[model samples]
Target: MRRVLLCLALFFASPLLANSKTLFLNGVYAATYGDIAWDKGDWRGSNFSAIRLKAGIQVVRIDFVSLTLGFQKVGFYSGMHKWSGDNDIGFDYRGPVLELHLFPDAPFGFSFAGATGTGYSYLTSASQYHYSSCEGCKIDAERSALKVGEFTAYVTYKISSQLEILAGAGTRSVKGEIDYDVDRGGVHSWEKGDVDSWKESNTMVLLGLRGSTL
Candidate 1:
């Protein structure tokens, strides 16, 4: 009985005792194209540029499988031409990620990882429009909750113990509604608009720079 209890304890504690934690950062560029519909009509066929930053920490690793938690920020350029004065939108997705690595012991390795989490979307735009005789005097800003998902499959070449070069294709999708407020001639109005289900799936090349021991 004593030996069995000791074996059980060791088995439960092995992962914590032997696991190595890793930290990585990546920069991503993507092209986004999607369709959106509003109360007026179908606003179809729009494309824009996007930039994203991903930072993660691998908290648990058991052989070829690892679990990480990451925070990502993505910015989208102006796709709506009507609101084209210094306008951009951003989303934040932060949550746990899971990865599967093939050839974990080799210098050349491949891995696939995916993440989904809580997200927030923000948009800021300025335009000159006539709203009830308020010509050229309206400014709009929007904020909303977004649902975000990301997936990446990459091949890695380890240049050193702490650095790797990664080339991969990634897909990210963001969907949400925007609650916007407009200010025109000192009067305020509120309206709701949506991203109308936007998905950005593009090819990305990234560099994986690992941090020192944490």
Candidate 2:
């Protein structure tokens, strides 16, 4: 009887010690909205919303949690608004990221954390047009993909053992050809190699919540 009781105590204690490792699922919602301006002061408003999935690993979780690494993927909605000929103006985007997190505890009983990461994004657009008084002005127009690299940072809080939240901002610098196809003279082409890209490098806010079993 004594031996059985001792074995049972050790079994429960072993589980608590081994449970130091945890896996969590996280979801993030983001919005990017801004306007574009040209030399003639032509401005237009554009905005997009995206969703992301993330998985994290806690390398160290003793005393104060030390390190965490994660991967996330984001997708955006961009489609044609109007079509003049075969030409249309539309948008499509995708981004992939790698992130690292660090947490520090303060004496006043408040906890803080910072996250930094790198990501790559790709975008494609199409446009078409016809004469105001002409008919059957058929055109098929598309552009080569425009790609950019981005970096982001944020401050975070831990509301409880199972919940966490964050708020922050980031930027993206683009480098690619601004090539377009048109039907004015039967599809004219030009290699506009990096002639001041459009719609990138904007400030953003991030809000996230995470839950897990401890």
The best candidate in terms of lDDT? 1
Query: Ten consecutive residues with minimal summed lDDT in candidate 1?
Result: 32-41
Give lDDT tens digits, candidate 2, residues 1-214: 3533443344223323334323344422111111010011011123333333343434444454434443433332221222122322333333444444444242112222223333323222222221232233333433335464546665555575434454555654444334434344564543232233444444444455443222
Structure candidate 1, residue pairs in collision: none
Best by TM-score: 1
- What is candidate 2's TM-score against the reference? 0.44
Report the Cα lDDT for residue 162, model 2: 38
Residue-level lDDT for 210 in candidate 1: 27
Off by over 4 Å in 2: 1-45, 59-65, 78-98, 104-146, 176-199, 212-214
| Model 2 global lDDT (CA atoms, 0 to 1) | 0.35
Clashes of each: 0, 5
